[model samples]
Target: MPDTRSGDRQMAPPRPRPKRSDAEDNRARIIDIARTAFAAAPDATLQSIAKAAGVGQGTMYRHFPSREALLLAVYRTDVEALVEVAPSLLDAHEPLDALRLWFGRLAAYGRIKHGASQAMEAATRADLKSQYYPPVVAALDQLLTACKDAGHLRPGADADEVLLLVSFLWRAESGPDWQERTDRMLGIVVDGLRTAPRA
Candidate 1:
């Protein structure tokens, strides 16, 4: 009688550790290097970027399977940072001041993203926008709501409209001293938002 017992079943392997901090650090470094390399030239090679990042080509490939993957990673990282800052900003500063500071950071992020935009294909751009838009819009909406309730902004001041209005700054033409122009633009926006009449 060659009867097999229930113990004969093959057990699944145990899972790996929850977080790969080393992998995460490597991925972040790779993204940072890729952002610089791609910004200089969208067609920048993965070999050069990996070398610049002090990683093997295989490691870069593991973190980002494609050129588009690396580019999108950089953009998404920027968006997530901007979105994540909202709550902390609102907590640390006065409502109006928080909004101003958040938008100022957004202006800076926009400069980085503008350079990244050259690397994206149409489909990738659309996908990236879809993934990030709602969260960012919600963040801005929440900040606007807080500002209104705190008497920082007018009752009827609009978040989406404000998003559109300030988007021009995101696409602003880069020049030798574009940061000056960007700062001036943000100041004008903050002043306008502060002055809108309450209902």
Candidate 2:
């Protein structure tokens, strides 16, 4: 055995280090900035986003190799936030009210998706829809079921149909009055789901 132990140790791969807290904070700040930038303009540049985030181009590229990567990351973050808020909202409010509030957040996310989707490749968009649709629908279903169980919503109210009804959030043209219009439209949809007036 001619230094067999040393050779075995050299052949072992080094373990990867977990990301530092500072690095994670920087990444989160970049995503937040990029989300706002992309919602304002679909073609916002990566350099501009990095500058706005107070990070160097090197740091930006280290976290996200390209514009598409950053966009995807931002979308992923938004989706996760949307899903995670449903339970808390339900706990804090009546089911119908919770559903309405969750939909408000969903509408905001729709605005971001509308702006960002234009810059994404068709395949990437399709992939994102496939990956994210289930969890979103599941969250909606949870809220809808809560409302139904409480007799606040009609038994026949379907989550998929409700989602379809609100699809206009992303499809509608953006203008000064867009928020008012969407809010009114969402109210109509929520009202339609009600079974009867609460005593």
Candidate 3:
């Protein structure tokens, strides 16, 4: 004795969202572990890295395809991470401060990616830089413009010129004394970029 109208009133349960593929998760884990290992020692053995990443040789191979491929992926990931943070950086601080902070993060990113990035072929490296530099420069340009408009920087301040000076930041990633050297250099550059009286 079910009600005759019960069928009309019934509704289907909602469908569940699709889960992320396990292969993608495993690939991400491998890249993360490889980054740490490569940072600690640029020449760290792949066997050890695989072990540290908790993935089998076959799995790591399947994900990365090759060591060079893995290195390139890590480089791309680092650059993209820096690029992604630009707006947030500007939002969380004053214009000039945000510009300075972004460069500080830039120096750190150079260090993080330097080991493997330096291994890329000259032409390929140049291409990647060309592709990546525009977005970062665009963000920096906006920040610099804001600083000038706010009287925190000289009128006609050139973000491109300032960015050129930071090109050497990648080299600061090298050597045991890099921390002290990079801090002092970045400070000097930032100070020089400030308007008289931070007007």
lDDT of each: 0.81, 0.89, 0.76
The candidate that achieves the highest lDDT relative to the unseen native structure: 2
Order by TM-score, highest first: 2, 1, 3
lDDT of 1 by residue, 12-55 (tens): 79988776788888999998888777666767777889999999
- Runs in model 3 with CA error above 4 Å? 1-22, 122-126, 197-199
lDDT computed for candidate 2: 0.89
Model 2 scores worst on lDDT over the 10 consecutive residues at: 120-129
Off by over 4 Å in 1: 1-13, 122-126, 196-199
Residue pairs clashing in model 3 are none
> lDDT, candidate 3, residue 199?
31
lDDT tens digits, residue span 35-79, model 2: 999988898999999999999999999999989889888988999
lDDT of 3 by residue, 1-199 (tens): 6566866666779899775698788878877887877776776666787898888899888777767677777778877887887788788998877887888888877776676554555214347778888987887788888788888887766868888888788654588988788888888787777787423
Q: Summing lDDT over every window of 10 consecutive residues in candidate 3, give the lowest-scoring window.
A: 117-126
List TM-scores for all candidates, in order: 0.84, 0.88, 0.78
Enumerate residue pairs that collide in model 1: none
